[model samples]
Target: MSGVVEGLEGRVFTVLGAAGFVGQRVVSRLRAAGAEVFAPARGDPALWTRPLGHVVYAAGLTADYLVRPFDTVEAHVGLLARVLKEAQWESLVYLSSTRLYDSLGAVDAHEALPLRLDPGQPRHLYDLSKALGESLCHTQGQGRARVARLACVYEGAQDADGFLPSLLRQVMAAGAQPGAPRPAIEVPSSPSFERDYVHVSDVVEGLVHLALRGQHTIYNLASGENTSNASLFDGLGRRWACELRATLPAGPSEAPRIRIDRMREEFGWRPKGLHSVLDAMKETCP
Candidate 1:
C-alpha cells in the first residue's frame, strides 16, 4: 500500500454533478493534479455522446430524498443506467452513501456486508436507488466501475447542509455576537447519536484514487471512528463558550462505525477526525 496516490497527470476525466459541493472539489482536485477534466452540467445531452476517460458519478440527492423520491431514483439509478449503456468510459466511480448501512446496527459496516432493505418503506427509497446504481455499475459496467460509499462528509464551517456543518455554523454565529449572553444552542439529535465523519478533501482524494486505481468493486471512504453528538456539543460548547442543550433523549447510534480498511490497505489513505476539523475551523473563525 503506497501512501502516494498515483500520478494523474494528463489523464482524461469526466465528473458528473460538477456543480455540487463534493463534485466541485473533485473536479478542482483532478485538474490540479493535471488531469484533463470534463464537467457537464445537469441534463447536458453531451454526457451521452462524449468519450469520458475516467468517470466520477457524484450526482445524487441526500436530505431532500424523501420529498423528491422520483428525482432521487433518477439521479441514483436512471441516469447512471443511461451512462452505463450509452457513455464510453475506461473506468467509472460512483459516489454512494454510507447511510445505506443504517439498518446494520452495532456491526462493522464494511463494503461486502449484506444490506437489508425493504422497498415498501419510503425511507428506504434512497438506499434502494443507490443500491440499484451500485448493482448496475457492477453487473453492467463490465468491471470498469467501482463504488465509493462516502461517510458523513464535512468541510470546515462553510455554509453547507448536514449535521456537523449546521452545528458549526450555529456555534460560529453565537461566537460572533460580542457582548451578547452565551446562547443555549439546542441540538436536535440525541447525545448518543454518532457518525463516522470524513473530510471532503479526503473524500475527493479517495474518489480519485478509486476512479483511477481501485481494484475492489466497493470501498468505504470514511474516518473509521465514530463521533457522538455529546462529544461534539461538549467540544463546541467549550470552544465557543456557548450553552449546550440536547433536544432528544439519548439513544443508540443510528449509524455504525464505517470500516475503511480497504481504502487504507489499497491506497494508504487516512482521513482526519471530526474534532480536528472543528478545531481548525475555530482557528479561522472571526
Candidate 2:
C-alpha cells in the first residue's frame, strides 16, 4: 500500500499481530504494494529500526481470562505510548474495536456513543483495553494518530462458533443441508437484531486511507449496513446451500449498526455489502 504510505516506501511499517487474520492481510496488502512490513511478535527489537511508517497496532488478547486477569488494555496502551515516543513514525493507525460500545452490538452507532466503563462489572478486557488504548493514542498523538474503530472483520467461512472457519465448514461440508437447516442461525437475536460486518479488505482500505492522510481522527471503519445473522445465513445458504446454525439467542437489544460514514467521507472508503461478503467467502472456502 505505497499509496497508503505515500512517501513512506521502504520504511518499516511495524505490524504487531502479524500472524492474525487481519494482520496477515494487512501485511500482504502492504508488502504487495512494496512496503517494508516488520512483524515485531516474531522477533526482537533489532528488526524494528527507525523511521517507522505506521505502527498498525492490531495485536490483542481476548478478555476471556477473567480469574487470573492480565491487564491487556494497559499493556497495549503502554506499548503504543512507548512506540509513539520511541519509534520513528510520522503517525499511527491503532485498530480499535466497535465492541467498546453496547450500541455497537445491535446496530449502527456513531463515535458519540457512550463508553461507560464499570470497574464493578465484568467485561471483555479486550474492549476495555481498546477504549483505554484509543484514549491514550488520542491523548498522546493529539493530531498525529488515527483510531480506526473496526467492526467484525471476516472473509472466510464460519465454524460451529459462527466464526469464519465454521461458516466455511458448513458451506463446503459434504451434502450440505439447504432448506430447514439450509443454514439456521438460532440466536435469541431478533430478526431485527443487526450487526455491521466488515470485510477484512475494506477495513484495510480504511486503515490505508487514514494511514496515508487523516490523523488523530476516530473513523468507524465498517460496512454501515445492519445485517442480521439469520439473514446472512439464509442468503448464503440459498446460494451455497450450506447450513449455518446458531443455537443461542443474541444479547444486547440495541441494533449495533456500525456507521462508516466517516470512513467514506474521510478516506473515500466504502465497504462492499454482505451479499458480496458471502460470495467472496464461497470462493475462498475449500
Candidate 3:
C-alpha cells in the first residue's frame, strides 16, 4: 500500500464514477488512508439528497468519447452541473484532462494559458465538454471546487483503454507464452506521437491532494515531460526482447510539455517518469 495521506482519517469522501479506472484507484487510496468512502452507482438519487462531505468527480469518458459523444457530455458536464447545484459537499475536485492542450500548439502547457477550440471539428466535442465542466465548477462551485488537469495516466499492463496501457497490454499478451519467439509489435500511432504520461497512483494522489489541501482553483497533475511513442517502443523492445514496428510514419509531437511547478511547489509532489515505471513493470511481468 502507498503511504496514507495525513489528516484523512475518518473524513467523509464521495467518489463519483467509482467504477472507473481512475475513480476505483481514488476510492482504494482513500479507504487505505482511513477515510469514509461512499461510491455511488450511476443515477443514484442519494447523490443529490445526501450530504457529500468531500466530492471527487472522477466520472468522465475517454477512448470511446469520439463514438459516444452524448454520453461523454453527460458524464463530463450534465451530472456535474446537477451535483454542483444540488449536492452538498465540503469540497469538490473535478477531474479534467491535460489533453485539452492538444489544440493549443504551444510549447509549454500551463494552467493559466487561454485555450482555443473549433466546435466544427468532431474531436472538439471531448475538449468542449470538459472545458464546460471546468467552467461550471468554477462558476457554480461557490469556491469549494478545484480542477485537476490530469495528463495521460497509465498503470502498467492493466486491461484498460488509453495509448500506453493498450500498448503495454499488447506486449504482455504476446510474451505470455513461455519460450516463444520474440514478439513483433506493431504500434498503431506514429513514432513521434507523444504524451505526458503520469501513473494512475500519482493521479489519485494528486486528486486527493487537490480535494483536501489545494489552495489554487486549477492545478496541472502531470510529470512535466513528454514521452514519444518511439522511445516507449524502444524501451519495451529492449526489455521484452520484442521486435518493434510502427504502422504510421514518423511525425512531430504536437503536444506540449505540461507544467507541474504549481503541483510541486504547492503539494511537494513528483511523479515517476514513463521509462522508470516501465522498467519496474518489466521486472514483475510474467
Instruction: Please give the TM-score that candidate 1 achieves against the real structure.
Output: 0.95
What's the CA error at residue 179 for candidate 1, in Å?
7.8
Please state the error at residue 56 of candidate 3 in Å: 0.2
Top TM-score prediction, candidate number: 1
Give a tens-digit lDDT track for model 2, residues 1-286: 1123355457557787777667788898888877888776643675347566677777765534364346465445757777777767767888887777662445347876677565656665566767877887778775878888887777665322334445556456642543544434433434445667777777786677677778446888878876776786677666676555556665545756666666666666767887886676666653
Clash number for each model: 0, 26, 0
lDDT (Cα, 0-100) at 5 in candidate 3? 59
Candidate 1 Cα deviation (angstroms), residue 284: 1.2
Q: Give lDDT tens digits, candidate 3, residues 1-286.
A: 1332588899999999999999999999999989999999998888888889989999988989999999999999999998999888999999998878888874798899888888999999999999999999889989999999999888877646767777777777776355767879887678888888888888988888888888888899999988887888888877777867899999667778899999888877878888998888988884
Q: Candidate 1 at 221: error in angstroms?
A: 0.6
Model 1 alpha-carbon miss at residue 127, Å: 0.5
TM-score of 2: 0.81
Q: How many Å off is the CA of 52 in candidate 2?
A: 1.5
TM-score to true structure, per model: 0.95, 0.81, 0.94
Candidate 1 Cα lDDT to native:
0.87
lDDT of 3: 0.87
Q: Each candidate: what lDDT?
A: 0.87, 0.67, 0.87
lDDT of 2: 0.67
